[model samples]
Each structure stands twice: as structure tokens, then as C-alpha cells.
Target: MTTIKQDTDIPRTLQGLDDDRSSVRLRAALAAGTTPDARFVDKLIERSAIEPEFFVRDMLTWALTRHPVSLTLPALLRELRSQGAQARSQALHTLSKIGDRQAWPSITRALLSDGDDDVARSAWRAAVILVPEGEEAGLAAVLATQLGRGERETQLSLSRALVELGDAVMPALRAASTASDRRVRAHALATERLLHDPDAGFEFAIEEAKRVVALGGSGQEG
Candidate 1:
């Protein structure tokens, strides 16, 4: 393969994405999106998986969104099966941004409950976006299984995804509230609180739930 030197030539755009400097790579991603080139689609998806910088990864997502879904969608779906967690996570993130319902089937329960927290969080957000109509309840039940799975940020992501499913998640939340595990019960209570009071902060709800659970209570009271 011919090496793409760092220059203004359009042919070197893919190489620009791999530039040693973060700024150049950022601009390369930005330019790819601005131009919406099919030739750049594969390069962008490739870069997204390993991009160390958060902002650049975001821009790569934006670039993928700019391309035709017919092209980007298949590439992203393939990435979901990749052994690399970041590849799966970034692909899920891009798919969520794309908002293509066709990608819904790929958001498997395994991905939602992935051992890697970042991949799981990304899967949660993507699943909420790609869940088919009338399947919210089922998705909620699946998501509910992951209660108390991670730290505050991960729990918050799960809560927000469940909240996005609306009343469909209530049954799962109620069941989880009575779980033998205090962590699961607390998270469930906090999620229920957020559902009833959208204005409530997750931290406040979680802390309150913890207090209630500490008292050997169910934490289901209003």
C-alpha cells in the first residue's frame, strides 16, 4: 500500500487521520465529515476504534454519521462483533448517532451486559435508541437485569436508558426494588424515584435509597 504523506492533497485524507498530531487527526475527521466522502468511511470507522482522544472519537462518530448509512451501517455492525471492546463501543456509539432502526437487532443482551463497563454503557445508550417500537418493555426487563452492575456513572447510564423507556420499565423497577441484594434494591429505588420525579438528581435518589436500604427497609415508599 502506498503511504499517504501529510499534505493538502485529498488522496492523503486517510493518512491525515493517522497523523502523529492530535490536531491534524481532529481536522482530518472534521474534514471527512464536512466532505461526506465514501472513500473516507472505512478510514473513519477504523480510526474511531483506537482514537485515544475523546473529542476526536466524537468527531469520527460525526463523520460516520455524515456518510451514507448504507455504507456506514454495515461497517458498524461488523465492528460490534470485533474482539476489541473499544471497537464495539465506538461502533455502538456511532450507530446510536445514526439512529437507524435496522441496527436494532444487533444490540444483543450480551452486548448490554458486556463485562466491559464502557462497552456496556455504550450498548445501553445504543439499545435505547435502536429498540424497536413496542419492545421497550422487553428491553427494560433486560436492562433491569443489569442493576447494580457498575459504579455511579454506569448506574446512571442504565437509569437514564430505563427512564427513556418510560412506564414500560416500572414492573422491572418494582421487582428489582425487592431484590435481596442491597445494591440492586437501592439502584432500583433510585431509578423509580427518577421515573416519578424527573427533576430528582440521581445522586440524591441513590443516596436516599441507600439510606432506606440501610434501615433494612424495602425503599419502596414514596
Candidate 2:
């Protein structure tokens, strides 16, 4: 049985990257993507665009998945704005894993429907997680736009994120209940109502308490 080598071998193991064996080079590139070492990251970014084979490029993108969120997210965001489909898709996939506010500009900008369904879907999913925890206007805008496009997954994911953000999203959540899309409206309402039911979701309950305190807790007195 052939054992998979550890990432310790990493970039060095893929010595065949420029060799005749495509699989060898590709696997090596993917392995190199794991290290948080600064120099290795630069090498991955360099290879992301120039790698000859499509699958090798995919492996290089996969490497970015394990990179530090702070380092990898910024690089991936930059990649998202590029015109190449592979560059955008791979970067989107990695950012979805890290999901931070720093990801907002790129992911939110690409949230609209234009060309690819999967890429659009991935963008919405990442946006739902990465947007600021309390940016109601921004959250509503992204959700409303995607909801208008009739993507139920987008609506559901956004509603779930709003729920995760606590009652700060209540105003927007309430507004979303009136969305033009019935599915969006229903999902938003369900999320809003969950606040009153502790058993509905533990995370929602914790977030609700945090939101209440953040709002000065005056309402809970009544």
C-alpha cells in the first residue's frame, strides 16, 4: 500500500512540478499550499496563475485552503477580482472556509448573478458568514438582491447568518419577512420568531442575549 506523504515534504516533494509527470507536480503543489510560512504562500500565489494544467491549478487552490485565514483571505480576495474563472472559483472556495469581514468587498461585489451558478452560490454562502456581525443595511442589500434573483439557498443562508448575528439583524429580519420572494419572507419570519423560543437553537439564544445586552436590555424588562 502506498502511503500518502506528510506536508513536511511539501513543496520540495513536488520537485516534478515542472517535470514530465503531471500528477507528481500537481500533488507537490497542493502539498506546498498547506504551509503558513510566508515564502511558501508567495510561491502558491505565483503558481496559481501560471500553472500549466487545469487540475494542477486546482491543487494549488486547494493548498490555499489550509493557509492562515489572515494571510490566505486577503490573497484570495485579490484573486476573486481577477477575470479568470479558476482564479475566482478557487479563491471563493478558500474564503468560504475562513469567512471574515475582510472578505466582504470581494464576495459581496460578486454576489450577483452573472455567469456561473456554482460560483454565485459559493459567493452568497461566504457572504452570509463574512459580512460584519451587525451591518444590517449591507446584509439586507445582499440578501434582497439574491432573493430577488430567486435563489432559495441564498435567502436561507442569509437568514441563518442574520439569526447568528442576533437581534441586531431583527430590524432587517423583520423587513425581510416582507420580501418580494415568498421563500425569503417565510425564512426571515422563522428566524425572527426563533428569538422567543430558547429551545429553537442554542446559538440563537446566546446571540439573542448578547444582542439584548448590546441594546441595553431595556426591552426584556417588559
Candidate 3:
């Protein structure tokens, strides 16, 4: 049932990924993923780095995930070193989705604490996903350093990442809860609360932590 449209789909789809309109690019990414061709891999990674729209970039990541890891892993690891922040963030996001442990070694401390909040957030997510066995404590320690680093969204991302490491993060959270910076202490307490009660929403945990910090409590109250 191959029609002329089927025959032409490959070239048209590749070109569509670069179309001026984002909708076109989005469809192009979808098409590329729907029927993956190795030819689409490099172009997908390139476009993911510069794609302005979040949805489009997300589609691009989805498309990359559709490809084989052997094809995607090296390119993604190289992207971790890319000078562009979006490239690094997108690569980390994509790698997290891939869930390939082989990519674990590339998740370095510098990326975990990247100056850019988005990059750091993506790194935190990827690190949690890719962290090797027996490494959770070390990873948690590094993640704790970013406690209270940015705005609410960034702090929430950090807290969730720490919480994902499970009880292995307790020592780090305990140390951070006693830090001189009130913001860090509050964030640590909030993260500890989430670790204990997963159902407690971040907003409530953080507000309650703020109250504890205000009262000079580390939230380890008996």
C-alpha cells in the first residue's frame, strides 16, 4: 500500500523539521519519530538544541528517544559538553528519558550545579535517573549543595531530585537543615518532609519548613 506520499515522506519530513513555523516543525518531529530513520538522528539533535518552543523541543526529545541508544548515546554525551545551555539541558532531559545506565558516568558535578537553573534542574533529574548503585549518597551530597539556589520552581526541582534518592539523602538533608543560611535550612527541611510524607504537596512542605526555620527549628522536632 505504498503510495507516492509514502515514498516522499522521508524528505518532506526532514525538511519540515526546519520549517519557519513551529507547528510544522512539531509535526515533522512527530513524523520523524513515528517512523524513525537513522537519517533523522543528527538533525533531531541539532534542532533540539535551538528549538525555541517547549512543546517542539519536547517532541524533539521524544523523537530522539525513539532512536536506538547506540546512535543516540554518543551524540547526547557530546551535547553535555556543548557550550549552549539549551543543548546541555535538552541532552540531559533526553538522556533521562532514555534511562540508559551506560550514560551514568557522564553526569558530573559541574552539571549538577550548573550556573543556569534549567541546566542544573535537568542535570539533577538525569543524575537521579542514571546514578549507579551505591552512589546515591554521593549524588545526594552534591545535590544538597544547590539547596535554596534559585526561585521556587528551581528549589522544588532540587527537592524532588533529592527526595528521589530516598533515604540515602538523609545525611545530606540533615547537614543542610543546619546551615547558616535560612533559605537553605528551610529548603532542606521541606525536602526532608517530602521524604517522610510523599503525599504532602511541595507547597505545604515548604511553607511549613519556612515556619520551622522562623522558629529556629531544624524540623527534626521530637
| Candidate number with greatest lDDT | 3
lDDT of each: 0.92, 0.58, 0.95
Clash number by candidate, in order: 0, 0, 0
Worst 10 residues of 2 by lDDT: 1-10
For candidate 2, give the lDDT of residue 138. 65
Q: Would you give me the overall lDDT of model 2?
A: 0.58
Tens-place lDDT per residue, model 1, 171-193, is 99999989999999999999999
TM-score of 3: 0.95
* Model 3 lDDT tens row, 1-222: 566666689899899999999999999999999988788999999999999999999999999999999999999999999999999999999999999999999999999989989999999999999999999999999999999899999999999999999999999999999999999999999999999999998999999999999999997778
- TM per candidate comes to 0.94, 0.54, 0.95
Taking the tens digit of each residue's C-alpha lDDT, what string does model 2 give over 40-129?
665676566556687886777677666777777667768777777656665676676655677776665544443665466666566666
Residue 34 C-alpha lDDT in model 2: 49
**Candidate with the larger lDDT of 1 and 2:** 1
Q: Model 3: clashing residue pairs?
A: none
